[model samples]
Target: MTISQLIRPAHSFRLTPVVKVASFHIGRASAFRATKTIENGAVNEAVVLPPKDKVAGSYHWDFERLLSLSLIPLTIASVVNGAHPITDLFLGVILPFHCHLGFDAMITDYYPSRRSPVLNK
Candidate 1:
């Protein structure tokens, strides 16, 4: 009558529905544990480096932290409602170009070229 009954045919070898549900729960729990283990390992590796003085009177930006923070919201949005085209466009296109332009401006200001007339004169 229904798709499930049609597929099973009252004689197939499929596990009891309860067993299938339990198996899925167990699989998810194992995956969560594995993910936590990997995250902890990465944190330990990052902390193993020797401490250094603050450059430019501030701490260095940890790209790992930035990436993790960014991914959390993106992952939630994706899981809840698929990929948003506007969000993807901003992140994949606009953000990178903005960061690059900002970095280029900072570098040009901080490291003037000797070949430039303004710098030579």
Candidate 2:
């Protein structure tokens, strides 16, 4: 048998009708509301725009990962009393940064000031 016949069994596949794309697009100033049906049976929905600053632009994943990974080596050095001064220095610097990022993530997830309009500002 040929490779094409072996792979497909030839006439099994058929194409379906493609739906037309929506003419309207969501913009920055869009206000969200309940979906409403028009006389022609087309559905419409409102879009809500959130405050710009609610999404932070500056998120430092690299620095946060560095601080997290540093803890492992620093803890090991402290336990073994290896390279006392350098490890102490790194531990002092990294510990606070690690705590700050951890708490910041907790606050971002649980507290979520952005969801509350009054507190978000």
Candidate 3:
């Protein structure tokens, strides 16, 4: 065996089937929205999921816009209150969650875990 192959940990055998199962679930979820063709060779409109950016008047970009708009007020209130009990309580709950969402989105865009076929050692 090559030195590189010897050093690399074996890839998890479960990954391929897990991914296939997840794909099946997604297909099932969207099945109701599947398009249908009429006998006359015309296609009928199908139900579809809405884009996240409902606020921006753009039919796309929902998740980013939600985090941006929501965090602004939360940050302002937290700063103005300066750790007051009520603000502290609300901020404690929301700040970490918002930060998590933003970081998760960034990481997904930059280095998608799903895009890689093999897990890192």
Candidate 4:
């Protein structure tokens, strides 16, 4: 079977409100109430699936796979090409921002109890 045929056809899925909030925080923007839709027919599900009955350690770290699959190269090309130091610095700054936003969103969603103080008289 061809690669296209092997993968599931494009389907629509909606993120839950919690995930939407997380995404917004990661983007460092105000969360919107509108429904978001992602349509990508080019996705191959086989590429994402884990092997059956295999231990987690059986698979190797896929850093190259992840970098190859990401849009970082395009972003670097568009924003910073000549100056590697500037590009590295920019990414260093942005990475923490993205990480903190996601962390805050997840904590808010999953750990409401931790956010509240238990006042002991």
Candidate 5:
């Protein structure tokens, strides 16, 4: 790797899979969404698990531990203080984000590339 590449901050690997899994949630909600037909007469939805991210595996455990552990202090502060603005705000946001990461991991595991790549994407 070049100096510039090495020095640059690592791109976000965590949020990517979450985004891929979350893409289906974007746009308006519809009970029966129409599929697009391609030249070969096949659906061309582009969403898929962008090949495996090797970088993410290196720090996956660390990230999950940090996020979950962080909630301890925030939760304690919020409970002890009872409705303090900063604590309440962080707890509100971080809690949901933590939950999203967990569910994303679950989706990624159960829904492999060989199966429904759409949802696992």
Candidate 6:
């Protein structure tokens, strides 16, 4: 028997994917509300947007910039100094923290806790 014939038996069982990507075009935003209503006059809890701290927001941006800028000098110093203990220690802490801030920003912008809480971890 041919490979195709062997793969497809006399009795063929069709299967479909759980999620199909029919098109690359982006779809309009659609809300999926629950069809069922409250049984005994109960109400859905209000989901307020987390409070924003204006002062802290500015400070946060400033810190992000500071951390990133601080890396430049440390990076140059490390290359010039050639494997010094002090430079290694500084890079060890600052580099990870810098990366962490970038990741945190990405997470906050994309999978916000208010929306995709499950993806936070």
Rank order (by lDDT, best first): 6, 5, 2, 3, 1, 4
lDDT against true structure, model 2: 0.71
Cand. 6 Cα-lDDT = 0.82
**Which stretches of model 3 miss by more than 4 angstroms?**
1-64, 113-121
**TM-score: which candidate is best?**
6
Give the Å shift of residue 77 in candidate 6. 0.7
Worst 10 residues of 5 by lDDT: 12-21
How much lDDT does each candidate structure score? 0.56, 0.71, 0.63, 0.51, 0.77, 0.82
Off by over 4 Å in 2: 1-59, 114-121
The model with the greater TM-score, 5 or 6, is 6
Which stretches of model 4 miss by more than 4 angstroms? 1-83, 114-121
* Inter-residue clash pairs, candidate 3: 52-62, 53-61, 53-62
Q: Largest lDDT belongs to which candidate?
A: 6
TM-score on alpha carbons, each prediction: 0.27, 0.45, 0.38, 0.29, 0.51, 0.54
**Candidate 4, which ten residues in sequence have the lowest lDDT sum?**
112-121
User: Of models 2 and 5, which has the larger TM-score?
Assistant: 5
Alpha carbon deviation, residue 1, candidate 6 (Å):
28
RMSD of each: 21.1, 15.7, 17.8, 28.9, 25.7, 11.6
Instruction: Write the residue-wise lDDT of candidate 1 on 1-121 in tens digits.
Output: 8787667655666565644444344545556654312123544575566577666423324543464467567656767877789667646754565566557556666755533535422
In candidate 6, what are the lDDT values of residues 1-121, reduced to their tens digit?
Answer: 8898668764566576667877664465444545543233336866557888678689889999999999999999999989999999999999999999999999988886645666765
RMSD of 6: 11.6
Candidate 1 vs candidate 2: the lDDT winner is 2
